[model samples]
Target: MDLHLKGKNAVILGGTRGIGRAIAETLAGEGANVAVCARNAGQVAETVEALQSRGVKSTGASVDITDADALKSWIRKAGVELGGIDILVSNAGAMAQGNTPEAWTQNFQLDVLGAVNAFNAAEPFLDKAAKSHGDAAFVIIASVSAAQADRADSYGPVKASLIHFAKGLARENAAKRLRVNVVSPGMVYFEGGIWHMIETNQPEFFKQANSRNPTGRCATPQEIANAAVFLASPASSYTTGVNLIVDGAVSNRVNF
Candidate 1:
């Protein structure tokens, strides 16, 4: 598919590795200039280089997505550097699971507020892009856990909040041609990712978890990235205020 993404500019938060890295590479492959930000400077640099190698402009910065001010600055700088921000992907999460207050704070600040801040900081550029190109997008990388919870933890609830937030943004920004959507992935596995660590440290438990999925395995980062990029592309201009689940039948809960 063409995706009509040529020359478009995108910025992704936490785009150095895993799903985020896949999204960046996929966008660049489709001829979109991409800017990425993450806390690890080395990873950010490497990702940017890889994206650029695909023949699209790419740049990155070491940034703490939890710090509102620093995140805003990097995004705006990236927006200018990339010429404009047509797509903003909030792919960062604290990934701190548990019933502790610290976990709640981490998830709330990074997962929820990270998306909020990125949208706010990039709104002007997105609006400008929409005005010129007739469409713009903000895609949030949520998780299928938002719809199911096995225990009381901050991860699922925090992810659920993102779906709510994106829906509201879609409605409010419709007139401006700024599309907002969410992609919920389940059990995505990549090297150095949460699932990979578990797979290495606890083989039996990992096998049990993977067996629960109808596919008898987990999703790859590229699989999640594909859906995310599609949502962000102008090809899906009519898609908004929707949460697309890419869980590969792993989640049995009937989406109501």
Candidate 2:
């Protein structure tokens, strides 16, 4: 499937590991230059090197997404280095699950505001790309938790806010040929990921979660990445303002 993404440039948040890393690799494999950022300097360097191995121009920075000033600066610098930003993938999240004020604040700052700031900083670059290439995209990595209420947690609500925000951005940017969409993954499992920790430390709970999926397993990072990269590609040019769920049927609620 030629995504028609060759020569396109992408900026991905938290792209050093797990789902973010998968997305970055998939985009680079599809021939897009990628710029990534995460707090782990070693991981960031490794990911950038791996992406570059795929024969695409790749760059990375170690920065906290919660730091708006630093994040915006990285985004702008990435745009300058990559020539321009045709795609922006906000894949970082705090994963703060409690109802405490601290949890709420953490989720809001890293998950919600991170996307907000990244998009705001990348807007001019995206606009320029759209004007030149006739298409640009912003794909937010939300979660299926946004639509499910398993407990009283800040994670779900904060993710829900991202969907709402992306919808508005999609509507407002449609005229500019900039698409905005969300990929809501459910129980994606990967080594060193949250689900992996659950599988290791909480065996029974991990089994229960796996059983909840009709597929008898959680999604792999690659599966979720496939959806995200596709949405960010020109092949999905008509798809915008939509939350694409990759939950292996674990979610029962109909989106409509």
lDDT of each: 0.95, 0.95
Q: Give the TM-score of candidate 2.
A: 0.99
- Per-residue lDDT value at 151 in model 1: 90
lDDT (tens digit, per residue) of candidate 1 on 77-182: 9999999999999999999989899999999999999999999999999999999999999999999989998899999999999999999999999998999999
TM-score of each: 0.99, 0.99
Candidate 1 residue runs with Cα over 4 Å from true position = none
- For model 1, where is the 10-residue window of minimal lDDT? 247-256
Positional deviation of residue 207's Cα in model 2 after best superposition, in angstroms: 0.7
Candidate 1 Cα deviation (angstroms), residue 168? 0.2
lDDT score, candidate 2, position 60: 93
Backbone clashes counted, model 2: 0
Native-referenced Cα lDDT, model 1: 0.95
Clash total of candidate 1:
0
Candidate 2 accuracy as lDDT: 0.95
